[model samples]
Target: MRIQFMLNGSSETVDAEADTRLINVLRERYHLIGTHASCYSGECGSCIVLINGEIFHSCMTPLFRVRGMRVTTIEGFAKQHAYKEVLAGFREAGLSPCRFCAAGRILTTHALLEISPNPGEEEIAEYYRAVKCRCTDFRTYLKAVQYTGRLRRNRHRVS
Candidate 1:
Protein backbone atom coordinates (compact mmCIF):
# COMPACT_ATOMS: atom_id res chain seq x y z
CA MET A 1 0.00 0.00 0.00
CA ARG A 2 1.18 3.49 -0.74
CA ILE A 3 0.56 5.64 2.30
CA GLN A 4 0.80 9.39 2.08
CA PHE A 5 0.58 11.60 5.12
CA MET A 6 1.87 14.78 6.67
CA LEU A 7 4.67 13.81 9.01
CA ASN A 8 5.67 16.36 11.54
CA GLY A 9 4.91 19.20 9.10
CA SER A 10 6.26 17.54 6.00
CA SER A 11 4.55 15.45 3.41
CA GLU A 12 5.71 11.84 3.35
CA THR A 13 5.00 9.02 0.96
CA VAL A 14 6.02 5.44 1.52
CA ASP A 15 5.07 2.07 0.15
CA ALA A 16 4.38 -0.33 2.95
CA GLU A 17 2.14 -3.26 3.71
CA ALA A 18 -1.31 -2.07 4.74
CA ASP A 19 -1.01 -4.09 7.93
CA THR A 20 2.43 -2.72 8.77
CA ARG A 21 2.47 -0.99 12.11
CA LEU A 22 3.01 2.78 11.98
CA ILE A 23 5.69 2.36 14.63
CA ASN A 24 7.78 0.14 12.37
CA VAL A 25 7.50 2.51 9.44
CA LEU A 26 8.50 5.42 11.63
CA ARG A 27 11.45 3.75 13.35
CA GLU A 28 12.75 1.72 10.41
CA ARG A 29 11.80 3.73 7.35
CA TYR A 30 12.14 7.25 8.70
CA HIS A 31 14.63 6.45 11.47
CA LEU A 32 12.43 8.28 13.94
CA ILE A 33 13.44 6.20 16.94
CA GLY A 34 11.89 8.56 19.46
CA THR A 35 8.57 6.75 19.00
CA HIS A 36 9.69 3.68 20.93
CA ALA A 37 8.36 0.25 20.15
CA SER A 38 7.14 -1.73 23.13
CA CYS A 39 4.09 -3.82 23.91
CA TYR A 40 3.20 -3.81 20.21
CA SER A 41 -0.35 -4.17 21.41
CA GLY A 42 -1.35 -0.56 22.36
CA GLU A 43 -1.18 -1.41 26.06
CA CYS A 44 2.01 0.60 26.48
CA GLY A 45 1.86 4.27 25.63
CA SER A 46 5.51 4.18 24.61
CA CYS A 47 4.58 4.27 20.96
CA ILE A 48 2.20 7.19 21.27
CA VAL A 49 2.04 9.70 18.42
CA LEU A 50 -0.22 12.56 17.48
CA ILE A 51 -2.56 11.51 14.74
CA ASN A 52 -4.15 14.77 13.56
CA GLY A 53 -3.23 16.38 16.89
CA GLU A 54 -4.78 13.58 18.97
CA ILE A 55 -2.83 10.87 20.73
CA PHE A 56 -2.71 7.42 19.16
CA HIS A 57 -0.50 4.41 19.75
CA SER A 58 1.58 3.96 16.65
CA CYS A 59 2.18 0.33 17.42
CA MET A 60 -1.47 -0.44 17.02
CA THR A 61 -2.15 2.02 14.17
CA PRO A 62 -1.75 0.51 10.76
CA LEU A 63 0.14 2.43 8.08
CA PHE A 64 -2.95 2.58 5.93
CA ARG A 65 -4.98 4.25 8.65
CA VAL A 66 -2.66 7.25 8.62
CA ARG A 67 -3.06 7.81 4.94
CA GLY A 68 -3.93 11.46 4.23
CA MET A 69 -3.68 12.18 7.93
CA ARG A 70 -1.18 14.16 9.98
CA VAL A 71 1.22 12.29 12.24
CA THR A 72 3.55 13.95 14.71
CA THR A 73 6.32 11.91 16.30
CA ILE A 74 8.52 12.95 19.20
CA GLU A 75 11.43 13.76 16.95
CA GLY A 76 9.32 16.20 14.98
CA PHE A 77 7.64 17.59 18.06
CA ALA A 78 10.96 18.14 19.84
CA LYS A 79 11.86 20.67 17.17
CA GLN A 80 9.03 22.96 18.16
CA HIS A 81 9.05 25.61 20.91
CA ALA A 82 6.33 23.73 22.83
CA TYR A 83 8.78 20.93 23.44
CA LYS A 84 11.05 23.38 25.23
CA GLU A 85 8.22 24.39 27.54
CA VAL A 86 7.53 20.73 28.37
CA LEU A 87 11.21 20.14 29.14
CA ALA A 88 11.35 23.24 31.29
CA GLY A 89 8.22 22.19 33.15
CA PHE A 90 9.71 18.76 33.81
CA ARG A 91 12.83 20.42 35.08
CA GLU A 92 10.96 22.83 37.31
CA ALA A 93 8.94 19.98 38.79
CA GLY A 94 12.03 17.77 39.08
CA LEU A 95 10.15 15.07 37.25
CA SER A 96 12.52 12.98 35.22
CA PRO A 97 10.68 10.19 33.50
CA CYS A 98 12.69 7.13 32.57
CA ARG A 99 13.90 7.24 28.96
CA PHE A 100 11.66 4.30 28.17
CA CYS A 101 8.56 6.44 28.68
CA ALA A 102 9.80 9.98 28.10
CA ALA A 103 8.39 10.28 24.61
CA GLY A 104 4.93 9.19 25.68
CA ARG A 105 4.96 11.50 28.67
CA ILE A 106 6.11 14.55 26.72
CA LEU A 107 3.73 13.99 23.83
CA THR A 108 0.85 13.41 26.20
CA THR A 109 1.66 16.61 28.04
CA HIS A 110 1.59 18.55 24.76
CA ALA A 111 -1.73 17.05 23.78
CA LEU A 112 -3.26 17.80 27.16
CA LEU A 113 -2.01 21.34 27.21
CA GLU A 114 -3.41 21.92 23.77
CA ILE A 115 -6.84 20.89 24.96
CA SER A 116 -6.71 22.68 28.29
CA PRO A 117 -4.01 25.23 28.80
CA ASN A 118 -4.65 25.29 32.53
CA PRO A 119 -6.14 21.99 33.46
CA GLY A 120 -7.23 21.16 36.99
CA GLU A 121 -5.75 18.39 39.11
CA GLU A 122 -8.41 15.86 38.18
CA GLU A 123 -8.14 16.72 34.51
CA ILE A 124 -4.38 16.35 34.64
CA ALA A 125 -4.67 12.98 36.32
CA GLU A 126 -7.24 11.79 33.84
CA TYR A 127 -5.14 12.79 30.85
CA TYR A 128 -1.90 11.44 32.24
CA ARG A 129 -3.43 8.13 33.23
CA ALA A 130 -2.78 6.94 29.71
CA VAL A 131 0.98 7.11 30.01
CA LYS A 132 2.39 4.57 32.45
CA CYS A 133 5.60 5.62 34.17
CA ARG A 134 7.20 3.26 36.63
CA CYS A 135 9.96 5.61 37.68
CA THR A 136 8.07 8.75 38.65
CA ASP A 137 5.19 9.01 41.08
CA PHE A 138 1.77 10.42 40.21
CA ARG A 139 2.30 13.58 42.28
CA THR A 140 5.40 14.49 40.34
CA TYR A 141 3.58 13.95 37.08
CA LEU A 142 0.81 16.24 38.28
CA LYS A 143 3.28 18.92 39.25
CA ALA A 144 4.96 18.71 35.87
CA VAL A 145 1.71 19.00 33.99
CA GLN A 146 0.64 21.96 36.09
CA TYR A 147 3.95 23.66 35.62
CA THR A 148 3.78 23.11 31.89
CA GLY A 149 0.32 24.60 31.80
CA ARG A 150 1.54 27.64 33.64
CA LEU A 151 4.41 28.05 31.24
CA ARG A 152 2.08 27.75 28.27
CA ARG A 153 -0.32 30.28 29.70
CA ASN A 154 2.49 32.68 30.44
CA ARG A 155 3.76 32.38 26.89
CA HIS A 156 0.33 33.07 25.52
CA ARG A 157 -0.09 36.09 27.73
CA VAL A 158 3.27 37.46 26.70
CA SER A 159 2.42 37.03 23.04
Candidate 2:
Protein backbone atom coordinates (compact mmCIF):
# COMPACT_ATOMS: atom_id res chain seq x y z
CA MET A 1 0.00 0.00 0.00
CA ARG A 2 1.17 3.51 -0.71
CA ILE A 3 0.37 5.80 2.17
CA GLN A 4 0.51 9.57 1.76
CA PHE A 5 0.57 12.02 4.65
CA MET A 6 1.99 15.34 5.74
CA LEU A 7 4.91 14.61 8.03
CA ASN A 8 6.26 17.49 10.07
CA GLY A 9 5.78 20.20 7.48
CA SER A 10 6.40 18.14 4.36
CA SER A 11 4.36 15.70 2.36
CA GLU A 12 5.59 12.10 2.55
CA THR A 13 4.75 8.82 0.89
CA VAL A 14 5.84 5.29 1.73
CA ASP A 15 4.99 1.84 0.45
CA ALA A 16 4.31 -0.74 3.10
CA GLU A 17 1.75 -3.26 4.31
CA ALA A 18 -1.46 -1.52 5.23
CA ASP A 19 -1.39 -3.28 8.59
CA THR A 20 2.15 -2.25 9.35
CA ARG A 21 2.32 -0.05 12.40
CA LEU A 22 2.98 3.67 11.89
CA ILE A 23 5.81 3.46 14.39
CA ASN A 24 7.76 1.02 12.21
CA VAL A 25 7.39 3.20 9.14
CA LEU A 26 8.49 6.25 11.07
CA ARG A 27 11.53 4.64 12.65
CA GLU A 28 12.50 2.22 9.92
CA ARG A 29 11.63 4.11 6.74
CA TYR A 30 11.75 7.75 7.67
CA HIS A 31 14.48 7.23 10.24
CA LEU A 32 12.54 9.27 12.75
CA ILE A 33 14.00 7.88 15.95
CA GLY A 34 12.31 10.28 18.33
CA THR A 35 9.06 8.33 18.38
CA HIS A 36 10.17 5.57 20.72
CA ALA A 37 8.60 2.10 20.78
CA SER A 38 7.97 0.75 24.24
CA CYS A 39 4.81 -1.12 25.05
CA TYR A 40 3.32 -2.08 21.69
CA SER A 41 -0.02 -2.51 23.42
CA GLY A 42 -0.60 1.30 23.43
CA GLU A 43 -0.91 1.38 27.22
CA CYS A 44 2.40 3.19 27.42
CA GLY A 45 2.23 6.65 25.93
CA SER A 46 5.83 6.49 24.79
CA CYS A 47 4.67 5.91 21.23
CA ILE A 48 2.33 8.88 21.10
CA VAL A 49 2.30 11.08 17.96
CA LEU A 50 0.08 13.84 16.77
CA ILE A 51 -2.26 13.01 13.89
CA ASN A 52 -3.90 16.18 12.57
CA GLY A 53 -2.88 17.84 15.87
CA GLU A 54 -4.46 15.13 18.08
CA ILE A 55 -2.44 12.62 20.04
CA PHE A 56 -2.37 9.02 18.81
CA HIS A 57 -0.29 6.00 19.74
CA SER A 58 1.89 5.22 16.74
CA CYS A 59 2.59 1.67 17.85
CA MET A 60 -1.07 0.70 17.71
CA THR A 61 -1.89 2.96 14.75
CA PRO A 62 -1.81 1.28 11.33
CA LEU A 63 -0.15 3.01 8.37
CA PHE A 64 -3.46 3.18 6.54
CA ARG A 65 -5.05 5.10 9.39
CA VAL A 66 -2.76 8.10 8.79
CA ARG A 67 -3.10 8.20 5.02
CA GLY A 68 -3.83 11.77 3.88
CA MET A 69 -3.59 12.97 7.47
CA ARG A 70 -1.00 15.21 9.12
CA VAL A 71 1.39 13.26 11.34
CA THR A 72 3.74 15.05 13.73
CA THR A 73 6.30 13.09 15.64
CA ILE A 74 8.47 14.41 18.48
CA GLU A 75 11.21 15.27 16.05
CA GLY A 76 8.72 17.26 14.03
CA PHE A 77 7.22 18.99 17.06
CA ALA A 78 10.67 19.86 18.34
CA LYS A 79 11.22 22.09 15.32
CA GLN A 80 8.34 24.37 16.20
CA HIS A 81 8.33 27.34 18.59
CA ALA A 82 5.93 25.57 20.94
CA TYR A 83 8.67 23.11 21.80
CA LYS A 84 10.75 25.95 23.27
CA GLU A 85 7.84 27.12 25.38
CA VAL A 86 7.26 23.58 26.67
CA LEU A 87 10.95 23.15 27.42
CA ALA A 88 11.06 26.46 29.25
CA GLY A 89 8.05 25.43 31.28
CA PHE A 90 9.78 22.19 32.23
CA ARG A 91 12.86 24.09 33.25
CA GLU A 92 10.84 26.60 35.29
CA ALA A 93 8.92 23.84 37.04
CA GLY A 94 12.07 21.77 37.57
CA LEU A 95 10.37 18.87 35.82
CA SER A 96 12.98 17.05 33.79
CA PRO A 97 11.42 13.86 32.52
CA CYS A 98 13.70 11.02 31.64
CA ARG A 99 14.37 10.38 27.93
CA PHE A 100 12.06 7.37 27.99
CA CYS A 101 8.98 9.51 28.58
CA ALA A 102 10.15 12.91 27.33
CA ALA A 103 8.40 12.74 23.96
CA GLY A 104 5.09 11.72 25.49
CA ARG A 105 5.30 14.42 28.12
CA ILE A 106 6.20 17.17 25.66
CA LEU A 107 3.60 16.20 23.05
CA THR A 108 0.91 15.75 25.70
CA THR A 109 1.65 19.23 27.02
CA HIS A 110 1.41 20.67 23.52
CA ALA A 111 -1.96 19.00 22.86
CA LEU A 112 -3.36 20.04 26.22
CA LEU A 113 -2.26 23.65 25.81
CA GLU A 114 -3.68 23.80 22.29
CA ILE A 115 -7.08 22.57 23.48
CA SER A 116 -7.21 24.84 26.53
CA PRO A 117 -4.73 27.66 26.62
CA ASN A 118 -5.47 28.12 30.26
CA PRO A 119 -6.42 24.65 31.48
CA GLY A 120 -7.65 24.15 35.03
CA GLU A 121 -6.25 21.81 37.64
CA GLU A 122 -8.68 19.02 36.87
CA GLU A 123 -8.00 19.33 33.17
CA ILE A 124 -4.26 19.24 33.72
CA ALA A 125 -4.54 16.21 35.96
CA GLU A 126 -6.79 14.44 33.49
CA TYR A 127 -4.43 14.94 30.55
CA TYR A 128 -1.19 14.19 32.40
CA ARG A 129 -2.59 10.90 33.66
CA ALA A 130 -2.41 9.55 30.11
CA VAL A 131 1.39 9.68 30.12
CA LYS A 132 2.80 7.30 32.73
CA CYS A 133 6.04 8.66 34.16
CA ARG A 134 7.66 8.48 37.61
CA CYS A 135 10.29 11.10 36.92
CA THR A 136 8.17 13.77 38.61
CA ASP A 137 5.25 14.15 40.97
CA PHE A 138 1.74 15.20 40.01
CA ARG A 139 2.19 18.66 41.50
CA THR A 140 5.25 19.35 39.34
CA TYR A 141 3.47 18.24 36.23
CA LEU A 142 0.63 20.56 37.09
CA LYS A 143 3.07 23.41 37.52
CA ALA A 144 4.77 22.69 34.21
CA VAL A 145 1.48 22.64 32.34
CA GLN A 146 0.43 25.84 34.04
CA TYR A 147 3.71 27.53 33.19
CA THR A 148 3.52 26.42 29.60
CA GLY A 149 0.04 27.86 29.28
CA ARG A 150 1.16 31.13 30.80
CA LEU A 151 4.10 31.39 28.41
CA ARG A 152 1.93 30.70 25.40
CA ARG A 153 -0.66 33.20 26.48
CA ASN A 154 2.01 35.80 27.00
CA ARG A 155 3.55 35.07 23.63
CA HIS A 156 0.24 35.57 21.90
CA ARG A 157 -0.34 38.80 23.74
CA VAL A 158 2.96 40.21 22.49
CA SER A 159 2.38 39.08 18.94
Best by TM-score: 2
**Which residues of candidate 2, in runs, are more than 4 Å off?**
none
Please identify model 1 stretches exceeding 4 Å from their true place. Answer: none
Cand. 1 TM to true fold = 0.97
User: Who wins the lDDT comparison?
Assistant: 2
The residue-by-residue lDDT of candidate 1 on 8-101, one tens digit each, is 9999999988999999999999999989998998877999999998999999999999999999999999999999999999999999988888
Error in Å for residue 49 of model 1 = 0.8
lDDT per residue for candidate 2 within 1-159, as digits (tens), equals: 899999998999989899999999999988988888989988878889999999998999999999999999999999999999999999999999988889989999999999999999999887787778788689999999999999999999999
Q: Residue 110 of candidate 1: its Cα lDDT?
A: 95
